[model samples]
Target: MPRRHLHVTGAAEAPLRAALRALRTELAVPDAFPLQVLVEAEHAAKAPRLPSYDATDLPLFTIDPPTSTDLDQAMHLSRRPGSGSASGAGPGGYRVRYAIADVAAFVTPGSALDAEAHRRVSTLYFPDGKVPLHPACLSEGAASLLPAHTCPAVLWTLDLDADGRTESVDVRRALVRSRAKLNYAGVQKEIDAGTAEEPLALLKEIGQLRERLEVERGGISLTIPEQEITEHADGETGGGTYELTYRAPLPADGWNAQISLLTGMAAADLMLAHGNGVLRTLPAAPDGAVGRLRRTAEALRIDWPHHVSYARLIRSLDPHDPRHAAFLQECTTLLRGAHYTPFRDGDLPTITTHSAVAAPYTHCTAPLRRLVDRYASEICLAAVAGTPTPDWVLAAFDTLPDEMTEGGRRAGRVERECVDLVEAALLRDRVGEVFEGFVVDVEDVEDVEDANEDQPVTGTVQLESPAVVGRVTGTPGTPLPLGERLRVRLTQSEPGAAKVRFVPVVPVDPVDPA
Candidate 1:
């Protein structure tokens, strides 16, 4: 999925904030945790424990958005000689040390904090703010993997071969301190300028190697440019105005993601080996779906050779192209029916693989931001150490799927509605103006009240300017060609109702072949 952000200026912030609040109410998101939960959070902030290992000396660092405060995982990647006799006796390999915030340590089992977390399931984010699962005192303060702050963490040490294949895994609770807080753009700049320091210098090499391994394992990664709405002061009008642009992912972002992916795969392996734990599962795409996508590609004029895999073919696409963007949008049909599967008491999950990763995977990396990661981390730690899985975690395993699913759907609704509101607001004053756009999707509209009994055609169009996508009425006789560029005139835009509509403006000359 592509990332999105809405930056509203002071003038436009009030209405957007109100919409977000209304969305929270409509979604039934828990506004606040119970009083008892807050008390527990206060107490947990002061409690301390000694871990078996003090890894504060490790030159670990966190990379995230500049505004992020609830840091979850910090990492240090290096190449070193293998140790010991059984497994670590070879030449130097990659050593990946990932430190995940120990959220379980702060939220006690069967307590109000735990119960509230279960209710919330995951953090719900919006343009203005987020409704966090854990109290700020812990998630943003105590349990966060902040720089120069020694915090308890569930540390994962992965020993990988030269080709980035996992050779061994170790998980344990430890004390860690992040040396620095890094952001993607800055790190990418440093890397491009050849000024990247230790722990980040090897990121590209290791990340590319792991990417190769992923491709070899039949994994797929989509890299679509994200569309974001940013508000800025209008010099002429002296008021706030919004602008939309595409934000491409940096190389550092991909490299950092591989670290988290490595940890999740390791966590899944531990749980699956023990025949107990939660797995993020996605069935392989059906052959029919792939065939449909191939047809879509053909319609969009994208060459799909028989020799190339879908993953590789898609990766080769230029996201900036309208046809490529339409094809990528169509590819979403292939990645459907993802769900969490939990197994226990020697019972094996019928489905264990996450199709995107081409491996058994689970969530255990972002405990500070996600509720499931906390439970998954506890399960992985217990499974790796040959200790019994915590009773509370086991009890919640069966119900987590439902909770997470509901929360995910609600979050999706909130995101879509917010985007709709922004798009509507941006175009409300421009009704009847012509704009260039490409048809991305087509649909047939049936109206029984029509005396002529003729069905109307409608579809979605991605406008060239403003980067807005909205529904558009198509030509009556001719079906709108998907991925074809055209001129459209806005017919309706209601900011308060979060609605926008357009109508095709047929050209006087023949339409160019798409």
Candidate 2:
């Protein structure tokens, strides 16, 4: 019998549709709040004070996606002999000056904008559009690091050694104007072609230096291909799925590493110098992740060094190969959770702090989009200015560990709901059909254990395609390794319940033998 495409209808809607909609509505604040009242209170509390701007003459430029509007940062570079080195100011040690828009300049304390910003906490990124923090007048205009417009900014001047490690960090208030606004793809092309412009040339140089620094410092990084959906004008997918694979090339990775190295260095300096502040995303290492990966390697006949960093292996895995895809899925078990913490004058506790960055770092980038960044940036500012951290910022630090976590949970729910809706809608008609699948799990319907030994009493396995995890009924055979492949017939799929069940189609001989 010819298999027809499943056309599953929702119970009027996906189960999570209502829940997601409710959460979004609950979390979303009006785009703009009346500032007259807040502004008056702000002015009454403190007179307008602005940071010094001095880079207007230099052609600082911003390169972001074409659709990007909340431009938060701009950059320019100048090369000279390392102050004392004899490189003669030509292709010598370079200075990377990143001009971050001084958002604190406009959003004064105890004002309407500040209150609204606090309430919203962070910008929400949705598939269709984004919910911005400040209005366009500021986030996209005055406070934006737009091209050719001199703007007030908090400048970070990093002195790099021949390697990318910062010899010193010079933070100051400056006035700067950008030369051009470019995007990642364009800059990538320019780098690849080797015909680099003013900014691209600097980016290439710094990026190379940073890459070497990371490798030397025992850092592990991965280049995963992310898939994005785009509009397809012709065919069955006129509005179908299109996957976007981004090669985080040397240039991009280098650029990112430079930023990470700088931020991590800065964060370390601050934490050492000051007694207290909040650090972002520190998850305790997942227990038994290594053992599980070792088992996975043995089962799949893949050679992974037991002592080698998992991140390094992931980076080397070929994205184009089928085994790599399956291996990537298996590796997901080893990836641990992340967290935010408040620290006082004490030894830097050994914790899982940004495994990807391989550094003790905090969220200080993208303040407009991340709530923690805004708060952390303020902490950086206060520490830099040598003033007591503001009461509000301190309060935020205390409350954030919960609020942000809750916010993230809500965001995850919404995203998962959307994905489920799309997948259920796609698989509506394919009931009872058997498909080749990887065995991600074989556990009891209750008491599922995690890497940390915490038992999540649920019979579930996460799948790749439709990309979901749900409860399963039968407990296949023992010694069934997680992430093993098998043929399973989709017995039933309940869109309303957001449920999917699979029955193992027993094979004459074990299909996936090591």
Give the alpha-carbon lDDT of every model: 0.81, 0.57
Q: How accurate is candidate 2 locally (lDDT)?
A: 0.57
Which ten residues in a row are the worst by lDDT in model 2? 1-10
List TM-score per model, in order: 0.92, 0.75
lDDT of 2 by residue, 402-504 (tens): 7667656655554554444444434556777766655544443333434232432223343445443444444333233344555566766644445466656
Misplaced by over 4 Å in model 1 are 9-13, 48-50, 82-91, 233-239, 444-453, 507-514
Backbone collisions counted per model: 0, 14
Report the C-alpha lDDT of model 1 over 131-202, residue by residue, as the tens digit: 888999998999999998998999999988866778899999999999999999998998888999857987
